[model samples]
Target: MFTGLSAFPLTPVSGNAGIDEKAYGRLVHRLATTSVDSIGALGSTGSYAYLTREERARVARLAVEHADGVPVIVGIGALRTRHVLEAAEDAQNAGAAGVLLAPVSYQPLTDDDVFGLFEEVSAHLSVPLVIYDNPGTTHFTFTDELYTRLAHLPNVASVKIPGVPADPEAARARIEHLRRLLPATVTIGVSGDATAAKGLNAGCDAWYSVIGGTFPEPALALTRAAQAGQPERAERDSQRLQPLWDLFAQHGGSLRVVAAAAAHLGLTTPRNLPLPLRGLGAKEHAQVAAVIEKLQLHA
Candidate 1:
């Protein structure tokens, strides 16, 4: 579940209608039919922070039900430790193979505060846990010392680090440094879709991808090529999808752009994001459509 391409799908929510179960299920089922290694439900890409506990739990069940034997990793992050534990329990009861936890808080967290949360939660979890270190959303940067402490916890299976350096040597060194600090059992997975191939080629064990959820084939191609030790092939595959990555940069972030792509593909309705968050406009959607058509990402 921790290794390879773990695709995070959006939790398609229609305004006031709550979760669009059919569309969310469609997204998970689509990935299950492909070669993705695992399904990541309710991660940052899935808008886990925006949904209620009940909605998140239902989404977890739906993902597991439609995954077709692929392992499901459910995100269980919240502002409070108690709430995080509740979410974790719900995910485990729903048959998630593992749970992903990010240290989210309204106020800035000290290293001890973050460590204590993991210590308490890790002690109670039955399934494996992935340490989600997404500083962009959480605003909490993780030092190597913190990672070492968390990696030693009983169910700490992997650490999902942020993007690596763009230069090949720098990326390799960054991954290598983390490898030395973390225990041998814990794998290092990389986020930042654009740098996924570079991370993998540099020795990261997996990719926690956003685009892989919506378009599995291309992500799988790049992942497989990297895992097979064909770095050049992986790099070439990533280069081909530069347009889509560019759209992610231009359209704020991946959530809006991917929601737009999903809508454009008819996998979900337009404006599928939760309230206060809008999908791409007509001009942006047209641009995304053109890129999809040109890339032949019809899958």
Candidate 2:
């Protein structure tokens, strides 16, 4: 359903309670004006697990309404198959181009259990389904065998791999392994924001990105260079983003960093995430500002 950079905006909740609808409109508008191939609503960066179903549905509607023709992909992952089906229905009704599905789990899942989840969802989905293989969050890893099987399922369009091994040689080899097994039409998306540029160079078709969702221009620069085989330029720009990436690594990853950076840039209101997951403090906020300003990305 997509290729190139698919930017996942942090779901901005207004200070009072629910999603900041106006702020979300502005966020989607900002990304739609860029070279991004798609805008993903409720991806991990969007805090999908924290929001209520009503909020998730509302976010999907607002994202599609303001995306200005850029395809809006909603993260519709839920622990139960029935819940996922309901969210998929919401996404389709809201006019999202596709729905991102992950195998959310409390109890461990067997391969048949995981495959059956997609099978059930796909049977009811009219829109394309992006298989989110984020073991870090979902705790369910897709073996190559499983991915091969899922890739053959109806409505399955892409697979978002959350990690590409850090070693360049191993990373490329892993990409090749997936390429060898997956259906030719299925796009391989790389999602580790810290190493996205390298992943792009390693042959991932799309960057299912975190940092790029907040600061797309620089991310696109890196993606373009790598896609065009200009590794040196890609590396240079990726290096420029190292400071910001460091903050993500240090401060509970992209969910916190993007929310903090978005507020710092005045792109969204100052808001805390759902409880037990606090926003960045003053010290970390200062670090974000310094890095954004240093890279001249506050533009």
Candidate 3:
């Protein structure tokens, strides 16, 4: 199972309306130089849903190619089973370590339908799968029982559960149940720095981090703390991430925070957003820039 921080780099774009492969490689090169355990592109932060099928394939291919030895996992969130299989195939073809699977987006699907989609994915794809359970995007949350059933599927190697809760402790327990119930070969994961430390304490094997995509040094420090059983230091790092959380929640939607962080790091512009969604307005950019300035952390 993969552990520690994983970067979700912004998918770079050229001014002439094409993916800037050079910039994309530079981002991946930067991540490889960091201490992050892996780099996962094409997730929510990478604007996976906005990209066309070919564009998504290019992002996955480029991320893996530039990541060198670091495990590269590309998010595969498609409404159709055929599209899902195609994404998975593309990821394996690009040499990605695995695929991050999310259920059909926007439209609400039954829990059984979600599991069925993943089961179909498991049957055809040779690469290990990491379940992506981010309710903020799908508007559907999977329970421990449901997550376990999915994780136990053959070829399922890991799970990424975003820790979003009024009470971190309760969220931690449900995620832990997936880890405990699944076969030893399966890994349970969590993201959201606010609850990452708790997830690690609760027995999650990894942090499927977005912030790590921009600020790998600090994120890796937090993971190292957890690995060393240093709860005090981990807590300190978690507290430090509060500003990043505020940057997103203050405005709402998944892209703002990462985009803000990337802007702060001088890695990309705050105006850059993938398809289906546009860039942030000037006022919102000001707010994000102000908050990110306090963090004084850059790419």
Which candidate should be chosen as best, given lDDT against the real structure?
1
**Which one wins by TM-score: 1 or 3?**
1
lDDT, model 3, position 150: 87
lDDT string for model 2 (1-299, tens) is 37889999988875448777888898899999996989999988898888888888998999999999999999999888988988999999999999999999999999999999999898898989999988878888888899999999999999999778878888899999999999998999999888887788889999898876789898888888988999778878888888887887797677888888899898887774655577888898888888888888873
* Clashes within 3 Å, all models in order: 0, 0, 1
TM-score of each: 0.98, 0.96, 0.92
| Residue range 1-299, candidate 1, lDDT tens digits | 78899999988998667999999999999999996999999998899999999999999999999999999999999999999999999999999999999999999999999999999999999999999999988999999999999999999999999989999999999999999999999999999999999999999999999999999999999999999999999999999999988998887679888988899899999879988887777998899999999999985
> What value does the lDDT take at residue 190 in candidate 2?
92
Q: In model 2, which runs have C-alpha deviations exceeding 4 angstroms?
A: none
Q: Residue by residue across 1-299, what tens digits does model 3's lDDT show?
A: 37777778777653237676777788888999885788988988787777788998998888878887888988888889889888888888888888898886667888899989988999988778888888877888887778778877888888787874536577666765564678888777787666787787666788887777777787788888988988778878888878777766776754666665566567764446654455566787777777667877755
lDDT comparison, 1 vs 2, better candidate: 1
Clashing pairs in 1: none
Residue 196, candidate 1: how far off, in angstroms? 0.3
Clashing pairs for predicted structure model 3, backbone only? 7-213
Candidate 3 achieves a global lDDT of 0.77
